[model samples]
Target: MWASILIASFGTYVEKLVGYLLPHHMLERESIRRMTGLLPVSMLAALVAVQTFAVDQTLAIDARLFGLGVAVVALLLRAPFLVVIIVAATSTAFVRWLGWLP
Candidate 1:
């Protein structure tokens, strides 16, 4: 586990270092700029997918997925960020309390 963690951390550091060392002109390309702008959203989406669906390397849906759904609805309604988080957590807890999920 420690070896894997170290390798992943080192790889990420190398990737960032390479980015930093790349030519400014290359980094300034429109396509590169567009991808950089979208990187955060892509990372967040991946995070959400991993958290919502994966457990012990297996896909398993539970309160988290439901909470995400509630959060999505709240977002669609233009709810505040705090409200979105509160609603998602509350819904998750409520579902768990009701034994609706394992």
Candidate 2:
């Protein structure tokens, strides 16, 4: 488990290092450009979906979904990323504190 964790960390670092070391011209290839542009958003969306919906290897419907809804609304309104996070967290905490989510 420790070895796998280290390997994954090293692989992630290597991927970032390669992304940084690659030349702008190489990234200018149409397919590469499109991929590079979409990759971050795609990754973020996947991360968000997984975190918002999955808990203990099962699909969940809870305060997290409401929090993510707040985040999405903030994003759609052009709020800064920090504000989006703050709003999401605040709403989630409020709902949980109010005993509205289980």
Candidate 3:
């Protein structure tokens, strides 16, 4: 386990080092810029989907889906970030408290 951790740490360091060593012109290219900009959003969406719908390697239909729905509605209504988060959490908790979902 320690060897794996050290290997991973070194790999991460090398990745960052390569990023820093890349040519300025290559980094500034239009395709690279566009891809970099969209990468985080796509990655975040994938993460959220996985977290909301997966439980112990199986698909789940639970309070999280309702929470996600509430959050999306809040976002569409231009709610503040804090408000959206609070609302989603409250809704999920309410559903769980009511024994509607586990």
Candidate 4:
């Protein structure tokens, strides 16, 4: 376990070092700029999908989906970030409390 941790740490350091060593021109390219800008959004979407739909090793259809739907609607309506989060959490808790989903 220690060996694995050391290896991963060293690999991460090298990866970051290589990123720093990369030419500025490469980072400035239009395609690279676009990808970097969109990467976080895509990653967050993937994370949400996984978290909302997956339970343990299986797929789940439950209150989480309703919560996500509420979040999407809130986002479309231009709700503030904190409001969106609170609304989603409240909706999820309400659903769960109704004993409609486990």
Decreasing lDDT order of the candidates? 3, 1, 2, 4
Q: Mind giving the per-residue lDDT tens digits that candidate 3 earns over 3-94?
A: 99999999989967977898778678899889988999999999999999999899989999999999999999999999999999999999
Least lDDT summed over 10 consecutive residues: which range in candidate 4? 18-27
Badly placed stretches (over 4 Å) of model 4 are 1-23
Alpha carbon deviation, residue 80, candidate 1 (Å): 0.8
For model 3, the run of ten residues with the poorest summed lDDT: 18-27
Listed in order, each prediction's TM-score against the native is 0.71, 0.70, 0.74, 0.70
- Residues 11-71, model 2: lDDT tens digits: 9999789868988686668997788789999999899899999997999999999999999
- True-structure lDDT of candidate 1: 0.93
> Tens digits of per-residue lDDT for model 1 on 19-64?
7897789778999889989999999999989988999889998999
Task: Work out candidate 4's RMSD over C-alphas.
Answer: 3.9
Identify the candidate with maximal TM-score.
3
> What's the TM for model 1?
0.71
CA RMSD of all predictions: 3.5, 3.1, 3.4, 3.9
- Per-residue lDDT value at 74 in model 3: 100
Candidate 1 clashes between residue pairs 3 or more apart in a chain or in different chains: none
**Cα lDDT of model 4 by residue, 1-102, tens digit:** 999999999998996797789877967799978998899999998999999999898998999899989999999999999999999999999999998876
Better of 1 and 4 by TM-score: 1
- In order, the Cα lDDT scores of the candidates are 0.93, 0.92, 0.94, 0.92
What lDDT does candidate 4 reach at residue 54? 91
Model 1 scores worst on lDDT over the 10 consecutive residues at 18-27
